[model samples]
Target: MTDGDDMKNGSGPAAHSGWRGGHAPRWGTAACVAAVAALLAGLPWAAHGRLPGRLATHWSGGAAPDGSMPLWAAAVFPAGIWLLIALVVSLSRRRARAGARPWRGLVLAPTGTVLVGAQASVVRANLDRTDWHEARQPVWAIVLILALTGAALAVAWRIAVHVASATPAIAPPELDLPEGERLAWFSHAANPWLQLLSAAACLVATGTLVALGVGLASPEALWPVFAVCGVIALASGVFSSVRAKVSEAGLEVAFGPLGWPARRWSPAAIESARAEQRRPSEVGGWGYRLSGHGTTVMLRAGDCLVVRPRGRRSDFAVSVDDAERGAALLNALRRRDRAGIG
Candidate 1:
């Protein structure tokens, strides 16, 4: 296809150049996923003679077990879940642009470690048990599993950072501003669904707090409920709306109605600015997200103002209305700043 067609369809050499991880990374990811799946699925069966007919799969706060799964189910269930997660990661990776940063390892490494650790713990607990009920909760094993999971996540994140840093940033489209002309552009975006969800969460939290205050519910149980609901409300409310502005100074993006939290990039600090179409699913579903596509403040899917900061490999994008004008203004400002510096 011609250059124009390639650019329009996002399938040209420019797009391909963004991909730098090569086949090694993809192959390694696949191998790790397969290995984890195999280990989880085979662990129980490997010790079949020593293990009971069923396994203690769940435990409450105490040493006593509260849930049980048959020998075959225990082995297959976790493996199936691992495979499903792998499938999703694969699909999302496919949807992401070529040469986008790798987020697969960050997700899979910790998940696989947790599942494998849990499967091992289950087998160790039921190794010589006569019945599933006789299996003791491996408290120490749980702690060790948590520690290992943290280590695995840390390793994965470090690897991802190295890979991202090694890849080159895509050159963003630029626009020219006329001499002696000053310009500014503004746009706003909001998701009513997120707003309503936030409101509902806030109401739930408020009701729970009131219940605790009036002695209508247990303080211990209701406090956790209040904490969860409050957190959801705060996050959803903050990301439900956004305002983007580009001017001679640079680009500024403010979040929420109060706009207490905002991000600003001076014209000099911005390498390039462009407008692009993006979706919540592309950035791993809504709000502020860090994924293969980079850091995205996704309020609603559509036009987005995307910018690459000087000396940074990843771009930052925010959903907004009239993003094309905003991006144009930012690019012009950056050019003007560059000329002044020169």
Candidate 2:
């Protein structure tokens, strides 16, 4: 799941892992995002003279128009949102360098554009109208838009999953544990940087919502703000901490409180384990990273244990303290499992 130009490329496990990142696939996905947004944003303009010059963009109570905008603004607002998404992606890419997940942005940008277009579609129908009840959006139109958006999201995720799974696995260096020591390894790690990032994102979302409420932005734009806040809160929960353990049973990775639904590899599942040093670019930046070669739960990125599980094309790398000891223990337990030792 990682790699870079300055990274030391060695033989026999020093550095058998790297990325197959290509710009063609990246740009293909971005184009897909923009194209979908363009098509949806064009709906009102295509309808042309049938619509009015001023549009009722929002409603109050249940049936009266409380907010309005120029027809041109209403027509192109979704496209503007699409461009804004592109700009944000560009900035993040510049900041991240090797940390950027452009593939993810491929999924996010278009899905957001679709949802924005859905809302605008209703407003387009209500143009030149003052009565909210008469201008109420058609239920069928809303339902259809939702259905399409959901389908598009599912397809995009499937594509990303395929790309991730196709990543090549790197073999870990062979090792043996200390004499007289039973096979076992355990360690816990917390990423304060990730917690701080999530907290900052949540605060920004809260600020934006406040601004929208005070009329700094369109009142109807609250849905996207709410969605952003919820996602940040969830990230705050899932990536706050990570725990890795290897024993006779297998290799287990548990994240967050109590680790209720952890990812585990049975004794028969792990192919190899090793202690390794990693760069941020190798794992595609911070907080539970994914790359063309594997997946990594990274914090500051230094010492890590890379695990290759059986029947999978990619490996797993987790940044933690005492990874050398843990990797040795893991290899020992794997040997014990093969020998059926007590």
The residue-by-residue lDDT of candidate 2 on 1-342, one tens digit each, is 242111112222321223222343455445545654554465456544555556666654455556766667766776677667766776676676443353564556446636554545554556445443355555565566677677657655654553343232334533344444433445556566555555456545644543442233466677587677869856865686666766657777877533534788877788998988998887788778899759988865688888898888898998876687677767777777787655
Question: Which regions of candidate 1 are displaced past 4 Å?
Answer: 1-181
Clashing pairs in 2: 1-293, 1-294, 2-282, 3-282, 63-132
Clashing residue pairs in all predictions, respectively, total 1, 5
TM-score against native, each model: 0.48, 0.43
Question: Model 2, residue 66: what's the lDDT?
Answer: 68
lDDT of 1 by residue, 99-192 (tens): 4446577888899878877887777777778998898865687898899899989877765664443333333333335566554555556666
**CA lDDT of 285 in candidate 1?**
91
Number of the top-ranking candidate, with TM-score as the measure: 1
Off by over 4 Å in 2: 1-183, 203-219, 257-261
Worst 10 residues of 1 by lDDT: 1-10
- Could you say which candidate leads in lDDT? 1
Root-mean-square deviation (CA) per prediction: 16.9, 15.1
